[model samples]
Structures are given as structure tokens and as C-alpha cells.
Target: MAHTITGRKRLLARVRRIQGQASALEKALTDGTECAALLQQIAAIRGATNGLMAEVLDGHLREHVGAEGLSAGERERELDQIAAVLRSYLK
Candidate 1:
């Protein structure tokens, strides 16, 4: 998780933005926001989440799957891990 630790501040900033967006969504709902506006908020949240996932997933792949000098077996295991995570995320 070294890559993540190095980028923790940036990632946390993204997470906080998502949190703020969700909070605004809730507030909008309570204030009777239009359907279009609500849908836009949801889309924004999804986009932000996807960006975060992409960033972390890239780091994970670099660290585990594509690290130099890794044995074939280790790379395979990392591939399996990524597959499982992708499966769960897709669901």
C-alpha cells in the first residue's frame, strides 16, 4: 500500500469531494430538487468513484502484478486478486 500511502492526501481529497456531493444530494432531495438535477448529482458521484477506483487499481497493478522481478506465480495471484475485486465491483 505504499503507493496509496504516498497519494493518501490526494485520494482523501477526492473522497471528501464525493462525501460533499452525496451530502448535497441529500440536501437537494430534502429540498425537492428536480429529477434532472438529482440524476446529475448521482452521475457526478459515480464519475468521482470511478476515478478513485482507477487510481487505486492502477497502483495495485503496478505494485503487485507488474512489479519487477516478481515470480510468475506472484503475478498470477495478483491477477486473480484484481479479477475478484473487479467482479465484486461489477456486481
Candidate 2:
């Protein structure tokens, strides 16, 4: 969102790090890394991804759903959108 533009750099940095982590995981699989190390890598990736999702979702809740100037209709729309996204993401 435009409100998140201020934090875009930080978000992008997190995404880049996650990309690098995924690449490392790929390389590790190619090299047949140990199971423990592989599990650690996978966990790290999942945690980082969840962190990114939480950050964006928090921003959306604040700027789009919970903002003082937003009408009930607008808030409902934003809530529905986020709920749909949460359902999909959970699956």
C-alpha cells in the first residue's frame, strides 16, 4: 500500500534476505546437506516469511482497516479482503 511506501525499503530488504535463504536451501539440497541443517534452513525461511506477512498485514490493518477517517463500508471491505487473504494463506 502507499502508506507502506515509507517502509518499502525495509520490506524489500527482508524479501531479498529470504530470497537468499531460499537459494541457499536449494544449494544445500543439491549438495545433499544433513537433515538437521536442512530443517534449520526450512524453519528459517518459514519464520522470515511469516515475519514479512505480519508486517504487511499490520500496516494494512492500521492504514486501511483501522484508520479514523475510514467509513464503515470501507472498513468492512478492507476487513473482508484481509480475511480472504488470511484464509488463503492459512491453507
Candidate 3:
């Protein structure tokens, strides 16, 4: 949640793309498009969203674990938080 400005910009772009995908899905539904095709679009949007999340996760790990120069206790806490998040995401 405490991403740098550049990271925020990247996240904004991903969000905009997801919004566009949602809009497309809405239009497809309104137009009575094929359900299978719509499902595929939904899957694509899900993948995009997951990809964005992964990027943020990786960035967070690098910033907090690699370059922050934290104390041992702080690093362990960050690792625990990261592990918990990953477990939830995988589930």
C-alpha cells in the first residue's frame, strides 16, 4: 500500500486496463454476445488483475526485504507478512 510514485503510476495503468475490460464485458452482455466468449473475456481480465498483483507483490518484497536495510526483526516481520499474503492468494 506504500508504493512509490512510479509504482502507483504502474498500478493506475493496470487499473485503467481492467476498467476497460469490464466495460467491454458489459457491452458484450448488453449486445447478447456468446456466453462462452464473455467467459473468456472474464478469464482474461482475471489474468490481467492477477498479473498486476504479482508485480506489486514482487516490488513490495524487493523494497522491504532487499533495499530497505531493515533490522533483523523488521525483516522477519516483513517476511512473515509476505508469506501470509502469498498463502491467502494461493488459497
RMSD, one per candidate, in order: 0.8, 0.9, 2.0
Count clashes in each candidate, considering only residues at least 3 apart in sequence or on different chains. Answer: 0, 0, 0
Candidate with top lDDT is: 1
Which residue pairs collide in model 3, if any?
Answer: none
Give the TM-score comparing model 1 with the true structure, all chains together.
Answer: 0.95
**Using alpha carbons, what is the TM-score of model 3?**
0.81
Tens digit per residue, CA lDDT, model 1, 9-57: 9999999999999999999999999999999999999999999999999
Off by more than 4 A, model 1: none
Candidate rank order under TM-score = 1, 2, 3
| Native-referenced Cα lDDT, model 2 | 0.94
Prediction 3 global C-alpha lDDT: 0.88
Which of 1 and 2 is ahead in TM-score? 1
Q: How much is the lDDT of residue 83 in candidate 1? A: 99
Model 3 Cα lDDT, one tens digit per residue, 1-91: 4665668888899989999999999999999999899999999899998989889988887778775669999989989998998899889
Query: Which candidate tops TM-score?
Result: 1
